[model samples]
Target: MASSEESFLARRIDAEAFPLAVVDVLALAAVLTIGVINHNGVEYLSTNTVGWLLTLVPFLVGWAVAGPLVGAYSAGAAESAKAAVPLAVRAWIPGSIIGFALRASPLFSGGFQWTFGVVVLLTGGVSLAVFRWLFFKLRG
Candidate 1:
């Protein structure tokens, strides 16, 4: 009887691991997609190398924020979405700032200025929200 119970528990653990892995993969894909779209649409002041570096800034910052906010890597999928919101907001601020600064660089023909800033802020917020929503759904 004890052996049977242990086997059942192990199966449950394995089931849970699969979903968590899926969530992480989805989150990573979403972030990467956002970066690619933003880079393709926006013109930057730096050379290709600099532009690539700048492109990663927002995604990295957002990921850092989301990881702690949603407890993605540390707390696991069982954490509540409410606990993640503040961290998401904190992450958005810096990501927006960095994105805006990059857009203003003279490497591009015309600086997007306000438009780019708004887009970055919106993108960060939306991305975080979507990620959190998906996380909660999967966890529940």
Candidate 2:
């Protein structure tokens, strides 16, 4: 059995995962925005705000939904990079799929491209893995 102090400390550490999720979303948003600019030019962002959101929101929603489902927010994920990085990458696979599905849907503006999906999978996975690894290193 755990003592109260130990349990409290564990809870404190676990609570930090929430911020990881937020950062994951932010990191992916930046990556997605950069991707948009790379293909459509920077002016596209300013002139087509709705189009940008249409591009952005689905991925964010996908990550938000998939992270918890994949145990990305569990206490183990917050403990170290060895744990978090794989979880982050595993979470990204389904998250990207969901995002691609949402983007291909008629409600959104973009259609799914295999190349785009591959790029997002790779970039998002790398970004999440790097960030989660760095986050644990820094937290220590």
Candidate 3:
């Protein structure tokens, strides 16, 4: 890439992309873990870590990929609650839909769980919005 483009990519990814991702990943994990612990106990989390990871990691990677493509975290996007929250919601829905589909696929050993999809949609959507809100608050 050209020097100017490279710098833009570097700055945006480092400052915005990574931070949004970290926030999103943690939000999903925290909510998911809490439910699992309540229902299955803490030991279940440790024992089924691989399974949990398989369920969780895809959303992070998915957001990392789609967030940029969809302009979820772009320079032109407003960094305010009013603007940021909607953009984040728009960015997350498609990826969440795709993730749900994949989780439902027979190829997945755990099989389809509609409740899981709903939880992810609700938790991930709200979390991404919160990230955008926080991102702007931090910037100000």
> For residue 35, what is the lDDT in candidate 3?
60
lDDT of 3 by residue, 84-105 (tens): 5776788788877766666667
Off by over 4 Å in 3: 1-17
Backbone clash tally (model 2) = 0
| Candidate 1 structure quality by residue, lDDT tens digits, 11-98 | 3333333444355335544564556556664343333545555555544654544443333333333355664444455555765564
Candidate number of the best TM-score: 2
**Model 2 CA lDDT for position 102:** 95
lDDT of 2 at 58: 89
Quantify all predictions' global Cα lDDT against the true fold.
Answer: 0.52, 0.85, 0.67
Q: Residue 107 of model 2: what lDDT?
A: 75
lDDT of 3 at 64: 65
lDDT of 3 at 44: 80
How much lDDT does candidate 1 score?
0.52
Note the residue pairs that clash in candidate 2: none
- lDDT by residue (tens digit), candidate 2, 34-133: 9999989999999998888789998888987788777788788877789888988998999999999998999787899898899999999988888777
